[model samples]
Target chain A: MKPILECKGLGKSFGQKKAINNINLELERGKIIGLLGPNGSGKTTLLKLANNLLTPTAGEIRIAGFNPGPDTKQIVSYLPEKTYLNEWMRVKEIVEFFADFYRDFDPDKALTMLSQLGVDAKDRLKTLSKGTKEKVQLCLVMTREAKLYLLDEPIGGVDPAARDYILETIISNYHEDATVVISTHLIADIEQVLDYVIFLKDGQIALTSAVDKIREQEGKSVDSLFREVFKC
Target chain B: MGWDFETDRPIYIQIMEKIQLLILAGVYPVGAKLPSVRDLAQQAAVNPNTMQRALAQLEEEGLVITQRTSGRFVTENEEKIIQARRRLARDQVTQLLVKMRELGLGKEQILEIINEIAEEMKI
Candidate 1:
């Protein structure tokens, strides 16, 4: 089977500053991958490039044998770092909106997750706390049966309890054929859930290896390795 | 129900050890159906693939059996379970002996220490 996401010599620059450079990656389906890096390391940029939110200045990125476009968008579910929902809209409204917009969206699943999170669907987005909003966004994103999930800092805002639920939700929602790519600095919290990890350093691919391989060979956690690699 | 893992070891190996310990303790009794891989993964907060690998290792060791249509189950053979218990006990003893040797204790001294501790425990 073709890799779910593939990139070769992929580079993206914002005029003078290059966000990511000469990146080559081939991610398979049915795995959870962590994209680890410090601030300004281009983790978000890489995700955005794959999601077709940004055009690569050099090289090419393909999702399941096709370039990033409408077809790829249909298969890729993305949760950006910032909250993009309209504050005036109610939780159920947004859920309905997503259901209407994305063919793969499951409103029932979204509603169930929201209730499980103690979030009321009748409440407007503006009334909820930041953490709650993040939860809602995650619920929406995860309810989609996309082939690839690109989540940026999915657990950064929530408390430990919510973080566990989010992780469980992620694992339970995807099928054996879907791939989840999570970009975050909280490597320790999500390390166990990841099958593989790709370390991004200064706009370049630093390292990519199976999580178990890192523990077995390096005799250290992925979090420890990340700290050592990106230490100030 | 929490699964604790050491950072230095491979997660799948840790998971495999955990399941073996559970089986030995009768937590997952012989011939009992095991939970689905996804459920186990969620409970352990690890990847499903990792859990699958661990369960596969268990199957290879004859500690688990997977049916075609039905789910996985613990081995029904009591003899196999007994052998597994012995093997685990041997591994533990080997590790303990290695630690004793590292502490500069001779075989006689280690035996004496073990006898003293066993007497104290009345076993």
Candidate 2:
């Protein structure tokens, strides 16, 4: 089968700064992948190109064999680092908005998750605490039955409890045929859940390996490997 | 609940140990059916592929049996379970011995210490 996401010689630049350079990667189905890097290492840039938020300056990228346009967008569910929910709308209204916008969105699943997190459906987005808001956003994103889930720092800015819940939600919601790529610097928390990992370093592909292989061959966790690779 | 994995070792090895603990503890009783790979993955909050690899290791160890028509089942052999328990106890003693040697204690001294403690506890 064709890979769920493939990038061939993909490069992107912003003015004089290059965010991604000559990166080639192929992600297969049913694997949870970690895209790990430091702050300026182009992790988000690569994900943005994959989502078509930014066009590649060179080479090509494809999702399930299609360009990152409408067709690919249909199968790609993205949760950006920032909260994109409208503060004026209530939680149920936001759920309804997603239900109306995305063909694959499941309102019931979103509601169930929201209730589990103790989030009331009538509460305005702005009234909820920051962590709760993140959970709500994650709940919305995960309720969609998309082929590719691109989550940017899903555990960032949340408490450890929320981080555990978010990780559990991710593990439980993935379909057997879908692929999930999580971009985060918190390797220790996410390592056990990842099948494969990609390390981005200064706009380059530093390492691409399976988690178990890293453990067996390097005899160190991915977090330790990341620290060593990016250490000065 | 998510499985707690140690940082230094391969996760599959930890997973194998965890399953062995479960089997020895009678959580998955002898002859009991084990959960499907996907279900176990969800329960442990891990990737299905990772869970499948762990199950493969268990199957290789003969601690688990896979049926063609039905699903996987815990080994029905009581003797194998007892062997597994003894193997785990031996590993624990080996680790204890390594620590004792690090502390500059000889094997005979360690044995004498164990005897003293055993007498005190009357076991």
Candidate 3:
């Protein structure tokens, strides 16, 4: 399979402290990969570098064979660890913004999902419950027909009920041809859907394998292996 | 009908296999429709998404088929059930062997326990 994303000797530093170091990796299309790690393991930082929200202090990254330029941005949808949508915007307005920006935006899908989740499009972002807003963000991200999805902690702070809903939308709505790379600490909740697993530690990759291979060879769930590999 | 809370194995995959076992047992007869993904998920206390994934996997394996609006149904082919059962058995045996190894048990001990369980299960 051709890698849709590749990073070689990737490194990033915040002044004197390093967030990631000398990493090498590749992600193929049509796979759901979990980027698993503890906090400060450089999971978010590497995702940022992939999205080009930050540049690598060393090494290289290529999304769809192109550096993260406007062209690459068109193909990548990102859900940040923190809310990136303006709090002043209404829910419908946020939908409109994403619809306007991405050619593959599915407005009807977004509208249908919003109704299903019982989120009111008329409510201002400021008025909706924080958890609801996160769901809305995830829904909009799903509306995109992008090739690569960079979801940072998509279910990090949500209740288990909401987490299941969010994860379902992700699996059901992603285009069959698309690739989803979700970075989060919620392993057991997501261990079911993941086709691949990447264990990141200290900003470098510790393990990356097809989920099936990992399960077949290791004789343990990804959660168990993750605990053993990155003991807290 | 429901998910087992034991084992670190994912609940979705378990539900997926459980649905197949149900079909094999004639609980969901050939061509008989199954429960809604949401309802089954609720029954398992699993996220509906996990249930959907399990159902989707079944669809992919040809043991089940989905009709838009009508709902998912067990395939009429008994071969599909046989195949699904074989796959599930292989995985179960593999996991069992691994657990035995972890407990430092030899093949003789493992087979003895298997025989005891088989008598209990009457399978």
Candidate 4:
């Protein structure tokens, strides 16, 4: 089967700044992949390129065989770095909005997850804590049975306990044929769930390898390796 | 409960060791059905794919057997379990010997220390 997400000579620029440059990657199905980098390393830029939020300056990116467009959006579930929900909207209202917007969105699953996370369906987004808001957003994004999940810093800003819950949610909710790409600087917390990792350095592909291969070959965790590679 | 993993080794190997220990400790009794891969992965907070890989390795080692229609189960053969237990004990001994040798201890010294510990523990 073809890769769920593929990029060939993919480049993106914001005027004089080259946020992403010449990235080539292919992610397979049924795997959780980590897209890792430091701040300004183009992790978000690459995700935006794939999500169709920003058009690449050069090259191309494909999600499930189609370019980033309406067709690909149908199969791609994205969780942006910041919460984008309306502050006045209740948790359930956001779920309803997502259900109406995305054909694949499962409202039942979203409501169940919201309750599990202790975010009441009737609570307004403004009333929820930062971490709870993130959980609610994650619940909405994950309920979609999309082919590819682009989670940008999904665990960031959450407490340790909530982080574990989020990770467990990601693991248990994974579809055998779907692929998840989680971009974050918190490698140690997420590495165990990741099958592969792609390291981006200054918008360039520094390295990409199986997480186990790194441990077996280098006798070190991906977190340590990242520290060494991106040491200030 | 979340599974602990050492940083210097492959996670699947650690997961395999964990399951093997569970089997030997009778936590997962002989011939008992194992949890589904997704459930196991969620319990361990690891990826299902990684959990699947570990289970597959266990199956290859004869510690776990998979049925066509049913899910995975611990081996029913007591002999196989015995061999696995012995293998694990041997590995522990080999590691201890290596560490002792690195500390400039001779084989006799290591054996003497083991005897002292065994007597102290009344074993």
Candidate 5:
């Protein structure tokens, strides 16, 4: 089967600084993959390139065999690091907006998760706490029946309880055949749910392998290994 | 019940060990239906594919059986359960002996330590 996502000699740059370079990756289906790195490691750049928010200065990327465009966008559900919902809109209205915008969006699943997370649909976005707003955004993204989920820092700023809820929602929401790529600096929290991990460093691919393989061979968790590999 | 894992080893191995211990300890009684793979994965906070891999290993060992329409269940064979328990106990003893030997204790000293611990436990 064709890989869910592939990058060949992928490079991105801004002015004089290179953000990503020579990235060759092929992500398979049914895996929860972690795109891990510290700040300024191009994790977000790579994700944006994959999501078509930015064009690569060199090389190419493919999602489910299509280049990042209208075709791939339909199959890719993305959650940026920040909340994008308008503060004046009620949570229910945002759900309706998403349902209308994305053909794959499941309003029922979004509503169920929102209610379970104690998010009142009648409440405006500005009324919810910061973490609650993030939760609502995540709910909207996860409810889509997309083939690839690009979750950038899905659990970064939330409380531990909310983090767990987000991780569980991620695990249960996506189809088994679909791939979910989660980018975050927090490795220990999400390590168990990941099947594979990609470590980025200084605009290059540092390491990529199955999570169990790393554990068996290195005799350390990914977090420990990350510290060792990227110790500065 | 909570599942604690050592980070340096394969998760599927830990998951299999946990399920085996649960079976031998009667937490999942013989012939009892096991939870679905997804439910077990959620409970253990592990990936579903990893949980499935562990279940497949159990099936290979004949400690668990699956029905085409229904789900997995602990083996009904009492003798198999006893054998599994005995195998696990033997492995545990072997590991203990190896550790004791590494500490420079001969077989006689190991036996004495066991006796001392047993006596202390009886009180």
Candidate 6:
């Protein structure tokens, strides 16, 4: 299958400091990719490059054979690490806003997800707990029919139970033929669904391969390898 | 269904697989009781959620049977254990054979070594 996202010598810098350096990646369709890295290792920056949130300092990145821009954003559904939703918007209104902006957004899917989480659309976003808000954000992202989904820290916070739900929701809802790049530190949790992994360290690609092949060959889980290589 | 953390595999899978292995080994015995998920999870130092995933998977695969509130018990059908073992062994041998061929060991040489090793088997 053709790569859904391609990066060749991709480098990003902020001022004099490097964010991501000389990275090459090929994201295949219908694959769940885990982006593993220590804090400040540039996993988020690389995702941003794909989303066109930040322009690369050098080299190239292509999503679905197109450079990242408004056209690419249409195909890339992003869930930022921080809350991207406005606090004052009612749950129902926010869904409409997303539906209006993104042609691929499915209002019915969004409603189904919210219903599964027991979130009432009439409630204001500010009244919901932080965890609930996160789920709401997840519901929105999962509602899209994009060709690529860039999720940053989808399970960074919240309790362990919620983590399972978050992971399951992503897994069950994501459309096939689309690439899902989940940048997270929770390796053991999401590694089961991961077709590939990109381990970043000090702004560089440390390791990248099929998660199953690594497990089959090295007899090591992705988490253990992460601990050994990127251990503090 | 306790997990071994040392292996690269996830703890939840370890628990599921170990229980499956015990069933295959006849250690649990057919139709006998299995450890509670809570106890097994505690022994394995894993979260109950993880344990739940393992149990759910086992149940889905028909390797285990659960009763509501009465706790999970081993299934009477012993063929599942044998089937699991056969599948696992088949995979291992296929992998080993492929690797041996890559190392220039022909089938006869590999079988001779296997026979030699089998001669010293405790069983």
Query: TM-scores of the first chain across all predictions?
Result: 0.98, 0.97, 0.96, 0.98, 0.98, 0.95
Model 2 clash pairs are none
TM-score of chain B of 1: 0.92
| Candidate closer to the true structure by TM-score (higher is better), 2 or 6 | 2
Residue pairs clashing, model 6: A221-B8
What DockQ does model 1 achieve? Answer: 0.75
- State every prediction's TM-score relative to the real structure: 0.95, 0.95, 0.74, 0.95, 0.93, 0.69
Q: Score candidate 2 by DockQ.
A: 0.74
Stretches off by above 4 angstroms in model 5 are: B98-123
Off by over 4 Å in 4: B102-112
What are the interface RMSDs of all the models?
Answer: 1.4, 1.3, 5.8, 1.0, 1.9, 8.2
Name model 6 segments beyond 4 Å from true: B1-123
Q: Native contacts retained per candidate?
A: 0.87, 0.74, 0.11, 0.94, 0.55, 0.21
DockQ order of candidates, top first: 4, 1, 2, 5, 3, 6
What docking class should model 1 receive? Answer: medium
Off by over 4 Å in 2: none
Give RMSD (Å) of candidate 2 vs. truth.
1.6
Give me the displacement of residue B78 in model 4, in angstroms: 1.8
Q: What does candidate 3's lDDT look like per residue over A1-232, in tens digits? A: 5588998898999999889999888887877789999889998998888888899889899998888878898889988888889999998888889888899898888988888888999989999878888889888887788899999988977777777677667666666568899998878787766778899888778988765566657767788888899876
Model-by-model lDDT, in order?
0.94, 0.91, 0.82, 0.92, 0.91, 0.80
| Cα shift from native, residue A211, model 2 (Å) | 1.2
Compose the digit string of candidate 2's lDDT tens values, residues B17-94. 998999999999999999888778777777788888999888888899999789999999888888899999999999
TM-score, cand. 3? 0.74
lDDT of 1 by residue, A85-113 (tens): 99999999999999988999999999999
What does candidate 6's lDDT look like per residue over A182-231, in tens digits?
89888877766566889999899898987656766778988888898976
Segments in model 1 whose C-alpha atoms lie over 4 Å from true places: B101-109, B119-122
lDDT for each residue of candidate 1 in B1-123, tens digit (9 for 90 to 100): 248899889999999999999999999999999999999998998899999999999999999999979999999999999999999999999999999999999999999999999999999
Candidate 6 local Cα displacement, residue B76, angstroms:
20
